[model samples]
Target chain A: MHRTIVDADKQKLNLNLRELFNYRDLFLILAYRDLKVRYAQTFLGFFWAFLQPAATLLIFTVVFGRAIQVDTDGVPYPLFAITGMTAWTYFAFVLNQSGNSVIGAQEMVKKIYFPRLVIPLSKAVVGFVDFAIAFLILGVMMLFYCFSPSGNILYLPLFILLTIISALAVGIWLSALTIRYRDFQHVVPFLVQFGLYATPTAYPAETIINSLPDWAVAIYYLNPMAGVVEGFRWSVLGGAPPSDFAYISFVLIGILFMSGLYYFRKVERVMADIV
Target chain B: MSDIAVRVENLGKCYQIGHAKSGDFRESFDSWINKLRGINNGQTGESKEFWALKDIDFEIKKGEAVGIIGSNGAGKSTLLKILSRITEPTKGRFEINGRVSSLLEVGTGFHPELSGRENIYLNGTILGMKRREIKAKFDEIVAFSGVEKFIDIPVKHYSSGMKVRLAFAVAAHLEPEILIIDEVLAVGDAEFQKKSLGKMEEVTGKGRTVLFVSHNMGAVRDLCSKGVFLSKGTISQQGEMSKVLSDYVNSEAKINKEGGVVVNVSPLDKEGKWLKGTFLKVEVEWARNLFQEGINFDFSMRTVDRVKLFAFSSEKRPDFKDLHKRSKITLLIENIGYVNNELFIDVGFKYVNKDSYEALILNEQLITPSKEKIESFLRRDILVVPGFQYIIE
Candidate 1:
């Protein structure tokens, strides 16, 4: 046998991106399967993506806009709610689906050897398709409301990319944790539900940051979704750009993403056995 | 030098077998104490770690197909899992020179909602096959699996046999450098088993290394050139397939040789009775002797409560019996007509100090009447009777 000593200081894992690239067709097929099975028997099919955000916007606009009397900064409450809800819904969908992806594909994990990251990554990609459809609806709503955005809308892709990265970062950590402790599965949805209000999904970020102490605003901005929501709103609506606190949140998101990927790789080796 | 393709050194794996149900309070208390001590509290009292394979070291050269044969709980599966990287070793390491593909179980990578065509790509990808390679071999896989008509249907709708066929086809066709299969061939029907074995033969013929685990000795002999016999998580023997198999079987037979009497007899008749029309009692007697000396002996038998059933002495022998010593003898009555009820049959050998007896050697219990038919009890064909062997050394 060809023996090579494994150096402790050197990186043990050589993630072959080429190998993953070679399996791109398989990844696409899996992502397509997830999308197909999801809307297979449903009458609305892809429209359900837009419908979920639209329906949630209607409910939140009535509750927070009319009942709670939250300010929308001269934008129609429905339009504002739909835009933020679209991003939040994609985040929630990716979190929930990718959190359970490994467990859902336990058969594949236990039987074969593949990059375990493929399972969660495929779910994230499928969620992106949903996000795109919902974002289309938001674009139509923007047109109907006669709210023309400035040239800053070109940065919208960057914000969308940020939302996906954050979602995948948390998703990788959750997927790895859920394989061992099934309690994380129950904890994830509850966290997502509570996170809707915690982040500025329905209300403007300035409403919370302006009213709270500087320390509290800094602490609140540490949540990556806060930065993502604000960044998305600024890019799409050409409204107020994120302040220094949001930059710290961007740094925090990068750290979580890297650490989550590292932690996921470490746990990926033992998942077949422990799972 | 041997063309070694796989080398395993000091490889060991430990598994924690946890009780399915325990008191929640007891479990929590154990975890709390473990956490305070700063030990790994997550792996606590719910488990007791066991080394399935310990310090195992071996090597296999290129193009050598090895068979791992073992009894249940003999760590064969654990060894395969370690080699396949299905689980990491607790304390040890190994090096495999080539790409390893494992078929631990059939249909392992098949997604139920995906179509057969879709699953071929999915399973192939998981087996480490490239898209172009899968596309090139797609038709061959479908043809081998024999599910061309239903390739587009969801796999959940496929029969289990169909799924197994497709799974095996995908795995066997993938053409990995090293293949590890663990008892997957046991699931399919006989025809399919033959087909799978043929495919395995073809795989090995291509000069790829193969590690196969199975309990079927016949299949091991047929398929593998080298064999490793595992017993209680250790390699008991390793060599040519026939030699290792013989050693394994002989060791097992010798281990099971204690506390039993063997008798050679004709077939038993119907109604689960032996010698239905005969009236006779048969007794076998023997004594362990190291010295070849002349010593007269007598054989006797009795019921459980010391009621003598039959007795015989050296004088009963017709001729040439006086010249021998330390001899074993058997008393055979011509016909045992019927066993009236349940009885414990004992046999004893008389010596100078005391007579040692084989207690409760045989329980002649009559089940139902033998009057119905004689064909059943007439089929009692005893192949070998070690009880009749008189040991002189």
Candidate 2:
């Protein structure tokens, strides 16, 4: 015999992982649905996934690598830039998509009851698919550059995991905020634009971090993406290991992830009313 | 086995009515901060509390098909929302002894780009069916929706009726121990509606618990065994389906014998001057005991055949508030939506009672404006009746 109890109020937030697990099919379906809608009827279709980061990599190579002459140590510029762009593009896309996922699903959110977290998290899964496509493009560029990945390639999965968590942390926060204050809706695109220039996407992280002072360097790692982008480069290009300040980025990501979850749970309780 | 399928205790939902209507982000944020600082109590006359549902307690036994009937704003939907977990109540709790499936609307998650076949699987999963379960019922749902020829096409191209049929088919196939449906049977052609109603009767015949909310009296009478009538957020009557239906119809629609205002709206003034297009003047004179605050007056204009045309409520009028016991209300409605026809006017006054509004009285009036006077004054070159359909060639 099965029984379900519903209370008017919950005194504290419960991180009911078991309940979320029961709705796993919903998460997968939403992700699949988004992917289907995104590429439907377009002539290029799924290839756009590879083209976005690939095209951006070309622009960065011409503008930053050749025109500005940002140093890539000894590696070819396209190979060097694509690795960073791969991680950054996935982060930005996930953050932007998941940030608006709740608003985009106003119809479903207002009508039915499911784990609201499933909506935002599905964007994370979709982002991973796009990342895989762009990653495939990067592998061909690596072969073209005649570069072999180092033993550090084994640690690529850990860096990828870190990128996903950081993106989801910031994405969930912005998504919940968008519902309450639509100002965040306009603020998110600006954040993504400003974040692109602020991170070490155009140049190597070592180039900027090496010049900063002790205190400034410590503060620089507070941006979680700084370590992730550097880790992506290190894993693919066999360059210098991520700086010791990488530990600060890891801690920052953890704090952001926890607080993002807490803030989302708080706002989610009142979403049906306002949304 | 437990005979009780659902048990609700003291269920209540309160909304901040005034401020929630529509406000700019900055203003709302300021209000939130002021509320926290205790500088703004939020109990100001402008921002008052409204309990959409209060003190609702009921028990539904297994195999009981209950019909929940109420007029607009009567808390019928709010109760369903709480039971379906779409929103939480402010207080109390509920328990269910079986898997619950609630369909607030058909095609809740249907995407326009997805084909009918894909939507079947997608909507089936959303309604809490496993993939294997959906696969098993796939052919049955397709057969029921009867769009088999275009099953592979995107739903966007299908006619609206076809979309509703497919959506209803997916929803009705969900097998749960408890099913809650809300006004989803209004769509589709009459024959299709009848078929879906037949399917619902089949569902309840198997001894499953069902809670149905519908305005269709015939459908409710045919499907539901017990009935619950809600008036202003509280259960006013609960008993056999026929008894509750009669009570709701007689009280809400058949007019009240208790005191209410008699309305007189005229196209021509007392001086016999034909009034022009801009105003439909209604003068309501009532000399009765008045409630201090939260007094709402509603004026409904319906066709002579009893088809409702339009309704105007004084609750939205901030200026027409705080009135004395003996007074006359002269309303100047700009661009009234009407044609040259006889109409009936029903005036109703509602007041807050036990956190929800209860109708104090309702007065109905039969009005026939002078067509000759209105036509002579109304310019044939210009049509002043707002929302009236006109084809000028």
Cand. 2 Cα-lDDT: 0.79
True contacts kept of each: 0.35, 0.61
lDDT of 1 by residue, B1-393 (tens): 547778887777777678322223456567778878888846665567788888677888888889998777889988887777666677677777777778888766677888999888877877777788999999999999999999999999999889989988888796767788888878666677778888887887788888999765556766789998988888888989867876665454322112333222222344333354532323233334421233344434333223344444543444424423433343443223323222223332333344553222332211122333334321123221112222221
Best by TM-score: 2
Worst 10 residues of 2 chain B by lDDT: B384-393
- DockQ of prediction 1: 0.28
**Relative to the true structure, how large is the alpha-carbon lDDT of every model?**
0.70, 0.79
Cα error of candidate 2 at position A95, Å: 1.3
Kindly report the docking quality category of candidate 2. acceptable
Residue A107, candidate 2: Cα error in Å is: 0.9
Candidate 1 is scored at a TM of 0.75
TM-score of each: 0.75, 0.79
Off by over 4 Å in 1: A1-26, B18-47, B254-393
Please write out the lDDT profile of model 2 over residues B1-393, one tens digit for every residue. Answer: 779999999889989866643425767767778888888565433676799988888899999999999887889898888888777788889988888899989999999999999899888888888888999999999999999999999999999999999999999899999999899998898789889999999998989999999977667877899999999999899989978976775465343334544445544355432233445556765655645566766666655334555666666655556643435676654434344334456766676344343343332443434334333323334433343221111
DockQ of each: 0.28, 0.36
Local lDDT at B11 for model 2: 87
